[model samples]
Target: MTRPLALLALLVPVFTAAQPVAEAPVALDGTHQVDLVSEVNGHPYRLYIAPPEGYAADDTTRYPVLYILDGRRTFPAAVTARAFQDIYDGLDEVILVGIGNGEQTFDAWFSHRWRDYTPSANAATDSVVAVQFSQDPETVVSGGGPDFLRVLREEILPLVDSAYRTTGDRGLTGQSLGGLFAAYVLFEAPGLFQRVGINSPSLWWSDGETFATEVAFAEAHAALPAHVFLSVGSEEGRSMVPPMERLAEALRSRGYDGLTMDAVVFADETHTSVVPAMMSRTLRVLYGRSE
Candidate 1:
């Protein structure tokens, strides 16, 4: 099925659902499940939005939102852990927004994530699962990092701002490959997000090139205005530490007057087991509440 070059041109469908359903909560905290849908350049998007523990309809209290990657799988656990923290800390009130595929999980998470997070399309990029899983060519979504951010800026952020009493201070988070992507976004769009929490980031991807770029950006720039929390499993892999260290060192060397960074190696956690604890700690660190 060799399609014509004209049809093969860049005319992505931008598969998107309508705005999320802010339905009445089954519980009083407005902690119900919601999904935000949007599109960029014809590519559809669906993000998970989890309201605060006691999301009162009439309280009119603005909350900080956490934009999570791989929401389909992580949302449930995050919700449970958040509930626990809310009880333990007695101050766990915030929104958890999980960003993932609407109906196409693979594309929403992997393909689209790679395109939007990585700074380069080079085949040598590491920490990325796209090259290992991508299948379709027409539906093959890639190399739209900036475009994806535009969708977040134009479509998603506006919807969040208008619908809820949001503080306009958002946090971005992810695990493994997703975590690496978070680092990419932090450097690429410094003004968009205020905090980023990356757990077990796949810095090994891209041949450790992201560090050099990040260093260059920090050196050339005047100031950084966001806080970064990067953690990794000590026993995960040997190749992960140096790059992570380099990222922190780069920030320090370049002088982060406004940046608050905490990079730790969790000795007892694995790549897959660090998300829950990291989420709790990251929430506390970024939002100023802890359990």
Candidate 2:
């Protein structure tokens, strides 16, 4: 099995990534890009800005910015999967900014994502299922998510807001570890984003009781009102589904005065296949435009 296949194999209900699926291709239609170098708390980050298709200086229109994790892959794929041209054919536009690795992604995202997403890394005690990527397999530098988030807020978000015509209505997206981070941000900083799209989050990574974190957050923040979309591939890892359902129910009980939580299980999508599927839905749900 390929490395990706090996990763997905750990997940059950297996929609194998080995097979091909039909998806429409994207045409650039004159892409505009700007490479930016920025810093947050003294750490430097690289940013790639993909302006709206058919962009014009005189348009002067403010658009919703989509902040995508795993930008090395997701940014281009999402731009195409969402059928960029078709979605913005008539309606307003959006800015696609791909934030790449800062020094090291595995260390940066893995360690920090856990710290930011999970209520506590010490919460897990189970041994029946092993959560891959839970520990720093090599460097022993883990749990720095709060710092990563600071990079986004202080460095990335401000750059996009000032450099592009932004409406301040941002959408955050991630898959697996990234998904966990997205959900974490939602509960911890409810007002930071208007919408969040999470795909195949490793809910069971911390423990079977990750829902407790959300429940606790709701108890503390009475007015947490943000739209949330959660998805896990039916064929994903063994622990993906049950925890997803648990989280949905937790949100239901917590009550978000204006919260909209959607949990999706794609029967034919494994952990790997679900990325594109999630991106497709995320575009429609957040942007209000579908191809």
Please report the candidate that would top lDDT against the real structure. 1
TM-score for all models, in order of appearance: 0.77, 0.74
CA deviation > 4 Å runs, candidate 2: 1-44, 84-92, 102-136
Off by over 4 Å in 1: 1-37, 90-92, 103-109, 124-142
lDDT of 1 by residue, 1-291 (tens): 556755655344333534678787353243444454455657666666778856778897888888887776676667777777677664446788776655555554556666666555554333234345654444444456567678778987787778788887888888776778788788788868888987777787657766876877867787788888888877677776666776777777776668888888877777777777777677766766654
**Predicted structure 1, TM vs. truth:** 0.77
The residue-level lDDT of candidate 2 at 12 comes to 48
Would you give me the overall lDDT of model 1?
0.70
lDDT by residue (tens digit), candidate 2, 8-92:
7787455564677688754354443444443543434555466667567788777888888776567777778546536546334
Clashing residue pairs, backbone N/CA/C < 3 A, model 2 = 11-236, 11-237, 12-236, 13-235, 14-235, 112-144, 112-145
For candidate 1, the 10 contiguous residues with the lowest summed lDDT are 123-132
